[model samples]
Target: MKKGFIFDLDGVITDTAKYHYLAWKDLASSIGIEIDLVFNEQLKGISRMDSLERILVHGGKEQAFTLAEKEALAHQKNTHYVELLQALTPADLLPGVKAFLDEARKNAIPCAIASASKNAPFILDKLEVTDYFNVIVDPATLKKGKPDPEIFLKAAELLGISAKEAIGFEDAQAGLDGIKAANMFAVGVFSGEELHGADLLVERLDELDVLDLIRR
Candidate 1:
């Protein structure tokens, strides 16, 4: 039975993906690498530095920047992203997100965030749902990012649950892969071909039957 729920913050809880895209696009354009929404999808669930490296490689400028330069670029992108985040409020919670979190709370199901973004806590605070989660896995503490299972595993550990006892929710292919790799039941929130491997697929969290999921 699933005893806990682990979530990916960006797309799963709120729509920070747009802010992320805008920030990355701004950075990419400044670096002469133009990226559209399609390209931004590839950056989802990946670390900031990894995303920057991908953007650099896409522009054939991967070898042009030193590690220090890349770190600076990543920081620049994050600064803009945080600025965009200032507009976020509790009302920014996506459809069914607040309701589902409330249901989870009523059911006494522990919830944790396993996002690749280091700003998960800040985002949660901005959304005013910080109390809904029992743990927010610090991306800085992980040795690897999504598709590596490290983040999700760390979230489960911090929640005082086994990976197998957690149900992981994600909106990206890499996140779903990481959830499965961590031995958790995967719930994909996107209706995309890339999310085909999820054990339970839904376009929104409300579509999931929480009680049934827990009993599985």
Candidate 2:
């Protein structure tokens, strides 16, 4: 059977989640909404806009802004995120992650990025690993987010592989849920017991035998 690998972006690829947290924190503070660690946990694996909306609504401030106003706020948060990500490069690739990607390519095992991030492609370009993934399933191509399976399932479709033939590399419970919903095995990286459903979990990105798993 043909095999492929899929990955999430934020926590999986670069450490952009810190920047995301910062941006959201700033936005929440400006709106007099506290984005505590508890709120941050709820925002995991969810879209930026969705997270902001949730914060606003849950804080009883959603009605304060018009739709266009809310969009502007989301855009401003994205600008902050982009600014923080300006220093990202291939050198920032996680320890041994690039080596694993290279091995997968050398073994003819296809790969894709199944990210909820709309900026997945841009981030990959900045990291110079855009060529590593044969396909990238981003928010622009899907209506549903993590835990829905649409994104992962679409990635498999684009990679021409079945869900069972793909390994979904995730860093959060939502991503793991999406992978399992698509009927594929999940590889959790550094997440807590929330990722208990993962078929295989690793403490770091460098701990996997990419070629062995794909070929076997």
Candidate 3:
């Protein structure tokens, strides 16, 4: 039986979250709302529009901006994010991710990306890892966000595997929730702290026992 591994993009495959944070921070600053990393954590695994809404709530500008204005802000933030992403290179991949991809390829293990970022494709291309995926579950097509099973389930289906036979790696609570809610085994990837709710938690991707999962 072949097993599948689905991964979240931002912090799991690479550290583009910094670019996202910088972009969002710039957007907030434009609106005279100062945001810090501590508050930015709340935007993880969220949609672009949702992030703007959260920023408004945090800035007490929720009633100040109309829905259309908020949409424009989201667009402006994405523009900044795209500008930051232009500086990305293959060297920007978080440690061990390329090696992990190589190992999966050598073992003939299928992999797919299940990221909430609409820029997932762009980043994968920018980082030069687009060919590694069997299929990427596009977040734009989904009506629901992470912590919902839709994305992971779609990834599993695209990979031609059962959710039960899949293993998902995530760096956020919402991603973990989504993976488990899909009935797939979850591996929580973290840094400096162990995330609670996964079947296993590891600080880095290389620590994953891919061969063990294959042989089991």
lDDT of each: 0.91, 0.83, 0.88
Residue 1 CA displacement from its true place in model 3, Å: 5.2
Give the alpha carbon lDDT tens digit for every residue of 43-66 in model 3: 887788888889899999989987
Per-residue error (Å), model 2, residue 21: 0.9
Leading candidate by lDDT:
1
Return the TM-score for each candidate structure.
0.97, 0.93, 0.95
Model 2 lDDT per residue over 38-134, tens place: 6787787888778888989878898899889999999989899889888888887767688888888888888898887788888999999999999
lDDT for each residue of candidate 1 in 121-142, tens digit (9 for 90 to 100): 8989999999999999988988
CA error at residue 205 for candidate 1, angstroms: 1.0
Misplaced by over 4 Å in model 3 are 192-194
Which residue runs of candidate 2 sit more than 4 Å off their true CA positions? 191-193
Report model 3's TM-score to 2 decimal places. Answer: 0.95
Error of 3 at 4 (Å): 0.8
User: Top model by TM-score, which number?
Assistant: 1
Q: Which stretches of candidate 1 lie over 4 Å from their true place?
A: 191-193
Which whole-number lDDT from 0 to 100 does residue 148 have in model 1? 98
Could you give the C-alpha RMSD of every candidate to the true structure, in order shown?
A: 1.0, 1.7, 1.4
